[model samples]
Target: MQLVVARIGRAHGIKGEVTVEVRTDEPELRLAPGAVLATDPAAAGPLTVASGRVHSGRLLLRFDGVQDRTAAEALRNILLIADVDPDELPEGEDEYYDHQLVDLDVVTVDGVEVGRITEISHLPYQDLFVVERPDGTEVLVPFVERIVTEIDLDEQRAVIDPPPGLIDDRAEIASSRASREEA
Candidate 1:
């Protein structure tokens, strides 16, 4: 299987280095030197990583054939893909691949069916599961260990222990809290 690991951003300097919007949980392994990555447009690469570094908190990479800013600039917005084994799992027990979480059914601990995970939104600090409700509405559920209690692949389900107001309707949650406080 092939997984998208990063997107080529703007050319950094005149040194063939380009900024990357990293997509993988293990950038060190996926975007390392000598790593041959497939490109989105298919013409821009099969680029081999010559070198990589972190500059000003951003990931910068230089490809083997891309030796100048103009060449690197031409590859902008192209996605870099890495060939991965389907069975390959992350080193951490708590870690899960984005593909594994997407499409899982979501429910509360008490078994109230909430929705189905339609996408996994990967942000810099944290990841979120985009759940689509039966009514076609969507909610962004933070994929935190505290809130996302369990993931059962066999059942194709994810159990979440949502905080008060998280799963509840906005007006209902506020009104209920207000009434309780008044009493």
Candidate 2:
């Protein structure tokens, strides 16, 4: 599977250089000259990293075929992807990627299958799972250590002990909060 590692921000210089906002934690280690990256399907075709270097904590990349400012400017907002095997990822006991969690079956401790994970929210402190139930209700379950006790990526299932008042009510709460703020 290919995962996004960076997004082209803007043309950095007049010589076909573009500033890249790297999404990976190890940006310096991941992106380098000769690296092959696939642009997001919505943006354009895959491109090989012609040359790249860290500049001011961001990556300045030059694609193989892109030359001049006009060409580089056309790549802005394009996501860079790399082919990665999920099984090859070195994960700790409880750690998981947002991609791995998406579309996984979410079940309660009592063996009640609740829904499937449709999205993962990156909060300031922790991640949250957005589970879409069969009835179209969305559950916002915090992906905390205690709440999410088990994750089986191979089985595509997750065991969660949702905190009190955290499930099956996100839509109402969000709407109520929005209405209150507006008033």
Candidate 3:
């Protein structure tokens, strides 16, 4: 399996080290030196990591043969991919690959259908389920343990316990409007 590990960001300094927006949970294993990764833009890499460091809370990597800021600047915005065993899974029971959750039905605890999981949004803080509703609108459901109660792989559904005003806005909107009228 080919999984995305990181995306190359701006050139950090004049020393060929480029800032990286790491995608993997296991960056220590995936982004270490001597790890050769493929790139989205074929010209940017097949990059071999010479060294890595953490500067100002971001990952910085110096690739082999990319010896100057000019060379590093050319690699901006390319995604890095790693070769992995297809059968391998993350160690944690609650963890999952993005591919595994796509296209599943999203429902409330009471079995009320909310939407269909179209994509997984991997933000810095958390992952979100980008769900498409029956009417073609979309909603972002945070993929948190407290809200997402179940993930049934066989049944192909995700059961959620959404907080107030998450799945629906009519109630909150109506309440605000009534308050305005009272004032």
**Whole-model Cα lDDT of every candidate shown, in order:** 0.90, 0.79, 0.88
Best by TM-score: 1
Tens-digit lDDT track for model 1 on 64-94? 9898999989999999999989888878888
Which has the better lDDT: candidate 1, or candidate 3? 1
Model 1 gets an lDDT of 0.90
Q: Pull out the clashing pairs in model 3.
A: none
Candidate that would win on lDDT: 1
| Candidate 1, residue 98: lDDT | 73
Instruction: Give the per-residue lDDT digits (tens) of candidate 2, residues 1-183.
Output: 877778898998899999987655345545777777777765586788888876776669898889899999999898988776777653476566666778999998887888999877654356678899988878788887799878988788999888767664577789989999999
TM-score against truth, every candidate: 0.84, 0.61, 0.81
**lDDT: which is higher, 2 or 3?**
3
Output the worst ten-in-a-row residue range by lDDT, candidate 3: 164-173
Instruction: Report the CA-based lDDT of candidate 2 relative to the real structure.
Output: 0.79
Candidate 2: stretches off by over 4 Å: 6-34, 49-72, 121-125, 170-183
- Candidate 2 is scored at a TM of 0.61
- What are the per-model C-alpha RMSD values against the true structure? 3.2, 5.4, 3.0
